[model samples]
Target: MFEPIIPLVLFAIVATTTPGIATTLSTASGAQFGFRRSVPLLVGSAAGLATVTGAAAAGLAGLLLAVPSLQLAMKVIGSLYLVWLAIKIGRSGPPNLDVTMARPNSFLGGAGIQWMNPKGWAMGLGAAASFAALASGPMQLALLLGATFGLAAAASLSLWCVAGMLLARLLKTEWQWRALNIVLGLVLAASIVPMWRSA
Candidate 1:
């Protein structure tokens, strides 16, 4: 039971830090809305990822994995959502709307992006399955899986968001912001690669 802890922690760190749905969304949100304004989105993302991770650990994702049609359906839905996010980000004009201390829709958009991210699914599900196979008790395994994953995810996402904000601030120009959006669009587009690999 305890032996799996090391691997579990490693898995959590790697999965959370990897350039996937959460990372891309956080970075993009940071660029678009700034770090201070992306907190809700960050919280929502963490909540969603934690839910998915918990589900995976509890064998729910395995159930999803069992039904080939269902899995395919989820994949399709997730894929379409990501593509849509990229399109929306690409289409968004300059920041002429309104700038305030308030967090913007980009945060929710980030959470939504993670909700539909296939890589996120893979990470959460894989960690749960692999860790569960090693634990003797269900509750203990679930706690371990959730704690490690949740902490790692939160920290990693904060890094992404901060980096995005810093980059956006550094550029400090309308054109730079637009270019940032394009770069974010490219990142979102690249996120589909892992899904394709899994398929």
Candidate 2:
């Protein structure tokens, strides 16, 4: 059981560090609004993911797996959303610090996007399943797994966001900023390949 925790921890770390809605949003927020303002969004998303994963471990994922149609629905919905997000990212321009800084949508928008993300649900469920298999007691194991994964996710995401902010400082010119957005967008778009193939 204890040995299994190592693999589980690695899985959580990889899942959290992977570029997706939460990571993208955090990076965007940090690049635009700075880390201080983005903290709430990070915390909220981490908390939400922990709850979702724990619920999945408690048999919610099993229920979903049992329903073929529901699983299909999730795949379709998630795929479409990922594509939409890629398009949105491609269209995004450099952060207008003045405008974005004044925007109130950062925190709630970041958290909401992550909460609805289908890939996130899948990952959470998968993590829950693995943890459940090795856990001696369900609730205690879930809590332990949730806390460990939650912390990893929150920290990794915050680091990504902070990195984005730091990178923003290097773009002293408009072209550099636009180029950065384009490159990041391209990277994110390319990431959808795995998700599509999995679907």
Candidate 3:
């Protein structure tokens, strides 16, 4: 019983820690707003991802897999959204430490990202498919996967936020800030490859 769960835990860790749109946004939010104010975004993202995981466990992932058209549609929409987000990040100016000057991402916005993020969908689908045999029933599997993913997401997002805050200190110059944003934006845009391939 526990043996099967070990692999699931490892998968969750890897999936959550890997760079994706959610982590990218969390990093950007932390750089601009610091860890304190970015809490809601992080929380919302985790909740949204957990919900996705639950849906996957409930067989939505299988449904998507059976319908290539739906999967392709999701990929296209998610990729376009990521590209848009990358553009927004690339255009953003230096962070104003004064919270009043620039607002951090809102909770709803963060949740929305996860809801549409291709990586999040992939993670949830992979996790459910990989670990479905471990549980005795569907509800049990859904709860198990959702809880594990939620915890992993919380930890990974917090780490990314902290890393972003630390990087913010080093990005004092305008050029440094611009360079960082450009790199992050490019990385976000690059995620489209896997999404396309999966389709």
Candidate 4:
């Protein structure tokens, strides 16, 4: 019964920790809001991860597999949203010494991102494919996957956010901020490719 849980946990770590849209946004949130204020975003993302994982365990993955059009719709919407987010990140100005930068996202936004995140959907679908045996029934599977993945996401996403906060300290000039923003934005937008194929 418990044999499958080890691999499931390992997969959860990789799924949540991998550099993608969620990590990028978390980093941006940390850079602007710092770790303390970013807590809501982090918690929201955890909840979102739990939802996706649970939904997948509850037959969402099979439903998606049966309907290619639905998958396409998800891909297109998710891609567009990520592109818009990327542009927003790229356009953000350097930090103001005396003033705080705009906090563009919060708990709701964080949860919404995961809902629109192709990578997150792919992770959920992958977990359903690989670890369905971890639990005895659909509800059990959903709960198990949700709890494991959510905890893993919170732990790993925090590291990325903290890294961004640290990087913020060294980014004293406009050029440094500009370069970092462009790179992060590009990476976030580029993540759609693998996610597209995965879904």
TM-score of each model, paired residue for residue: 0.56, 0.60, 0.64, 0.63
In order, what lDDT does every prediction score? 0.62, 0.63, 0.70, 0.70
lDDT of 3 by residue, 114-189 (tens): 8898777766665555455566666777788888988889998998888777866676788887776677677656
For model 2, residues 23-113, the per-residue Cα lDDT tens digits are 7677777877778888888887887777666655556445554553554555455445545654665566655443343542344555566
Candidate 4 per-residue lDDT over residues 1-199, each given as its tens digit = 5543655675576557655677777787777778999888898888898898888777854555466456466556656766776677677655343324477467887788788887777667656654544556667778888899899999988987887778667777788877867776776566555444444
**How many steric overlaps are in each model, in order?**
0, 0, 0, 0
Output the TM-score of candidate 1: 0.56
Task: Show pairs that collide, candidate 3.
Answer: none
Candidate 1: stretches off by over 4 Å: 1-4, 60-103, 106-111, 167-199
Query: Cα miss at 16, model 1 (Å)?
Result: 1.3
lDDT of 1 by residue, 1-199 (tens): 4543655565566557645556766777777777787787787777667766665656744455355355555556655665775676666544432233244554456557667877666666555444444455555555666677778788878888787766555767767767766766666556555544535
C-alpha RMSD in Å of predicted model 3 compared with the true structure: 7.2
Which regions of candidate 4 fall more than 4 Å away from where they truly are? Answer: 1-3, 60-101, 167-199
How far in Å is the alpha carbon of 49 misplaced in model 3? 0.3
What value of lDDT does candidate 2 attain over all alpha carbons?
0.63
Pick the winner on TM-score between candidates 2 and 4. 4
Q: What is candidate 4's CA lDDT for residue 46? A: 85
